[model samples]
Target chain A: MSLTTDDVNKIAYLARLGINAKDTASYTENLSDMLKLVEQMSSIDTDNVTPMAHPLDTIQRLRPDKIIEDNQRDHFQSIAPQTEEGLYLVPKVLD
Target chain B: MTMHTKTLKQLSQGLQTGEYSSQELTLAYLNRIQQYSALNSFISVTEAQAIAAAKQADALLTAGNAPLLTGIPMAHKDIFCTQGVKTSCGSKMLDNFIAPYNATVVDNLNAAGMVSLGKLNMDEFAMGSSNETSFYGTAYNPWADNTVPGGSSGGSAAAVAARLIPAATGTDTGGSIRQPAAFCGITGLKPTYGRVSRYGMIAYASSLDQGGPMTQTAEDAALMLQAMAGFDPKDSTSAQQDVPNYSTNLNNSLQDLKIGLPKEFFDEGLNNDMATAIETAVNEYKQMGAEIIEVSMPHLKLAIPAYYVIAPAECSANLQRMDGVRFGHRCDNPEDLNDLYIRSRGEGFGTEVKRRILVGTYALSAGYYDAHYIKAQKIRRLITEDFTKALESVDVIMGPVTPTPAFGIGEKTADPIEMYLADIYTIAINLAGLPAMSIPAGFIDNKPVGLQIIGNYFAEAKLLNVAHQYQQVTNWHQQTPKGFE
Candidate 1:
């Protein structure tokens, strides 16, 4: 289970991280080394084992849909990198 | 006694009796933090804010309506949101991000009138075993300057050990709190998963991450944990179980207490001196009337691999929200949204964080999901069952916190596998959602070794009891570093 440079690039793209050509070699080496360690799990027989997501075998607790929190849009937007009139401004998507 | 040298219990008593005001105590800690600035323990010191909170605590004391922790100053790991304070999570990405609201842990402690000194440093997004991964430089172990303070809670552990503050809050995903506590010669607890509310505490791995106390003694950790643990409506995963008074059981007799020594923990990987230190502590437990039994955890060897897969996979999902638009670090100039996301994250995150995110993304990618994520989950179940079976036989499991004492800085940074293996003995408890604590047992080559006591799910009181009892018979927890003292 080794990651090629291309695989590292693709994974980086999916993860929304940029990797230049030089760094991709290091990423490939590190990710491949990690994958090698992870591959140790493949030998175990987990045919009957249940996949444990949470530590406790509990389901996610649901809450009433009613509004419990007041609107703090302005307060939140104050910390945004680019905001105007409580609207976060990102690069143009439809352009 | 110097205010910095006093325990949380003593500080509380002093404040209540008017021997010293909260203002005076907060000043003492702030002064110490400044004096010991080279340890790199604190990321941000809230001098003005701490003094203001101290003034409020004094007012509460005057009104005779103060909480147990009123006026006692401490630090929170930067992972917890601190309202107006910078919550960096020891990452460059969040270096400029000021939290809009308090984390539930911070709010709970603040409501108790506990004065926070500031935010302690940690591994970037809590990724590394060594503090070297911190965007801020490594927090040096106060005991040995060249040795690394075990982390991602290294800064918290080092601060507590250095007596910059009596205690500080720390989080553990894979031995972050306990390992650092072990390295720094302090007591740290990792309560059961969901024991403390995670609301506003930056998430690293939702399922395995838990916040706990790092302090001089298990008794202080008990007091801190009592305030920090409970259900919060804000955190959906917060357990609804009734919070127990952890301090009440501290003096409980260990008579006939069953302690399980897992056969796997004492394997060849454990260093000779660490094994000796752990054995010495076990002997002390035996003398105190604990009945020791050998227990076996067959899947214990697989904990590191299982944890790496699961924790990073979860981190990958949790960190996706850190796109430059809403908050956190953004590039100066971006050509487009995709460019914004890529460059901001790539440039903002440290090497270790990026590596984990990459591995996680690869693991969760279309073809590899079953082989990596699902298989890891199943292994996690096996590890949990192994703990369950062992705990059914004994009241607690005792082992060495780390394979050895703190290693020198940069010794293992180049090898990710070596760094990951540093957590082998501690990661299984998180996977099982059990409560565990690390107490300073003794020294190996002038560095402290920790004895880890692991309890059943929600048995934090029992774990604290075991640690507190051990602390009672030994003065290891009281030993401070040379210059810090």
Candidate 2:
């Protein structure tokens, strides 16, 4: 269950985090230790046991379709890092 | 007694009897915060806002319209959103971000006329077992200078223990609230999942994360929980059940109380001194005509493994919203959207947070979802079943809140596995979605030991009653940290 440097890099990339080359060794070591801890779960028998996502085992409670919150887009967008003309601005994804 | 030394209940009485004004009380606490600044307990102090709120509370008191919490001052863990104030969540990611609205708990406490002193420090995004992971810096244990106040609600516990505030709000995902409460020698409750609305609290692990009260006594916790609990339409997961009057049962006799001792909790991991303190607390309960039964949770050993997977998996999803565009920390310059996300998250988050995100992402990654995430979920079901079967014959379960008392600040940080093990005794209850609390039972080697009392779902009142009855005869809860007094 030891994570290689490549695996650490992949995980960081998947998580949308950029790890410097210097930290990769520590990340691999730390993540490998964590995975080793998680490896213990494989020894337990979970045969026929249902996977419990929510503790209560309840589904999301749906509300009637209605407008509950008043429009506060401007107020909400006030904290945005970059915004222009009522839209959030991000680095271009399309050329 | 000065306002800082008084318990929430006493402070409430003082305000009611006109012995002191809320403004005066608020100023006294603010002064204490200044004097105890070395503890690093608070991240933000809203002195002006606190004074203004105190004035409004005073007006309410004069009008005879004050609630029980009126004029009482407290601090909130930075995890809960506070409008117009920085809710840092102890991470640089949100250090400059001001909450646009109040968390439901904050709103409810405010509506009850309680004055908030400010935002307290915590483990970054409530991730670590010790407060050392906070972006603001580690919060020192008020009881001892070099030791850590157990976290991720470390500051909440430290501030209350230091008498800087009578009580503070804390959220427990695994053991954040209770462990810190134990470490700082105070009372903390983590109510059943959905018992308190989680509307604006920053999400870590949505299923296991629950907000509760951290105070000097169970009675104070009861008062705080009364104000904080209730269904909120905004939070769909909030339970629709009626919030019970937790204070009403505090004086109930412990006669015939069937307490179960989980054998696994007393096994190899528990420190010998902690075991003795927990055993002494159990004997006290036995002397009160309570019946103690031994229960087995064989799969308890699997809790740490299961929690690591499930919590991280959920955390990865929840924290996805923290991407640089809408809010939170954004990088200085970005060549592309991918670069923005990668650098913003990498630079903005602390080491622990980044580690968890990486772990979570790997657990939920395309090729590994079933082997890791699904298997962890199945193990979670087994752990929950263990509690269900044990609770069938017992009124509540009792154990050590943590494997040992508070350790040195940097003791477990070097090894993530060791830090993860610190939460072993407290994680299963979260997995079970049950109500549990930690009360100051005794001290070992000058550090505090907490006796963990666990109850069935929606059984907060019962848990409070159990802890309250114990506090009635013991002086442990009354012992304040030295010099801070």
DockQ of each: 0.90, 0.89
Docking class of 1: high
| Model 1 bad stretches (over 4 Å) | none
Residues B1-485 of candidate 2: C-alpha lDDT, one tens digit per residue: 56677888998899998999999999999999999999999999999999999999999998995899999999899999999999999999998899999999999999999999999999999999889999999999988869999999999999999999999999999999999999999999999999999999999999999999999999999999999999999897899899989999999999999999999999988899999999999999999999999999999999999999999999999999999999999999899999999999988999899889899999999988998999999999999999999999999999999989999978898898899988988999999899999999999989999999999999999999999999998999999888987
DockQ of 2: 0.89
Clashing pairs in 1: none
Question: Lowest summed lDDT over 10 consecutive residues: which window, candidate 2 chain B?
Answer: B1-10
Q: Which candidate is the best by lDDT?
A: 2
Name the lDDT value of residue B218 in candidate 1.
90
Q: Across all candidates, what is each one's fraction of true contacts kept?
A: 0.93, 0.94
